[model samples]
Target: MKKIIAYNMLMVALFTPICCAQDIARIVEDVGKSVVVVIGFNVDSTANKLGSGCFINNKGVILTNAHVIDSCLSLQIELTDTIIEVAANSNGLFCTTRKTIKIYLTKCS
Candidate 1:
């Protein structure tokens, strides 16, 4: 019936956010091992603090903010689990790597 369809649509809409959030959480978790937290500044003297990055390729490619790296020529990736650091660099935007990693955190944001 039309009423039933409408009710179902409403229910789905209400739960869509939860589903999307879960999906994002999964992505975050899956990439947490390859992701890193970055902090730096921008050219305009603004405090561009606190950001995150993830790897998407097997060649140690990393993605993050140009501003967060303070526009530096190179970068450093810190893994959450192994607590290891890797030297890297970015070309103004996003990095790439295919490595899967586990992120350890008391809270996720």
Candidate 2:
């Protein structure tokens, strides 16, 4: 019985990482679908900042760092082949009712 238990424990230890690796791979694939490129434009309409963010939900809500869109007059969100341009408000909020897009900013540093 002692030898059987030891063998089972060793088998579990070796297989556990394999199972976890599959889970990690699935998570990475899922997250890749939600990733987007955030481009910030200066007052002169030139792209000055670049960052990456992810869609938090299916309603076009994006979650990104505050610094990515800071001091910008407009922003361009690129997802796959779609590029969306929206104006930013003074309080760092980007909203466009026409496209039902909203951006939520958080300080990453």
Candidate 3:
């Protein structure tokens, strides 16, 4: 009886971590849609660049400094999740020879 009690107590200790992990998994799974992954490409590295755009309604916009996305023909916006999807591709905008791309989010739209 004494050994059985000790063994049961050990099992309870192991069970505690599993319960906590389940709680964390549930929270992340429920709120994953609110997160995003931002990716960009720029050919010119010497100058500072960025862009700013609206992301409300049916639009998924990318705004950055003037030098950030210069010469980038496209920008990719994806959801941060297991089945990550590239939700949008921005049409390129240029100032001088530098181009910045603006993509519309498909999934979010």
Candidate 4:
């Protein structure tokens, strides 16, 4: 009985990561729609830099790093289903939506 219990514990420990991974995968798949790629555009409409953001209130509020749009004249949000370009207002370290909103690219830092 002791040996059986030990074996069961070992099995659970080994499979725990796999189970967690699957759960994380499912969560990402479900919530990935809320994620967006924040693109900063210069005055000439040229892309400057890219950052990541997510919807805060589902009503067009986005939260992202301030540095992403520090010097940007405009902003564009790339979502899974659509892309939205709008004016942006940046404070010291926060972005507030003044208007209206990619895929699974496997690029890593």
Best by TM-score: 2
4-66, model 3: which lDDT tens digit per residue? 999999999999999999999999876564444444444442223233333343233433444
The worst-scoring run of ten residues by lDDT in candidate 1 lies at 100-109
- Per residue, candidate 4 scores C-alpha lDDT tens digits across 1-105 of 999999999999999999999999999998897888988777798999799988767566667777677667777778797776666434322233433421211
Q: List residue ranges in candidate 2 displaced over 4 A.
A: 80-82, 85-109
Q: Between candidates 2 and 4, name the one with more favorable lDDT.
A: 2
Candidate 2 lDDT by residue in tens digits, 3-109? 99999999999999999999999999888879999999998999999999898887767888788888888888887767888787666677764444555543445
Q: Which digits, one per residue and each the tens of the lDDT, describe model 1 over residues 3-23?
A: 999999999999999999999
lDDT of each: 0.53, 0.81, 0.45, 0.69
lDDT for 93 in candidate 1 is 38
Worst 10 residues of 4 by lDDT: 100-109
Which is the better candidate, 1 or 3, if ranked by lDDT? 1
Off by over 4 Å in 1: 37-56, 61-77, 85-109
Identify the candidate with maximal lDDT.
2
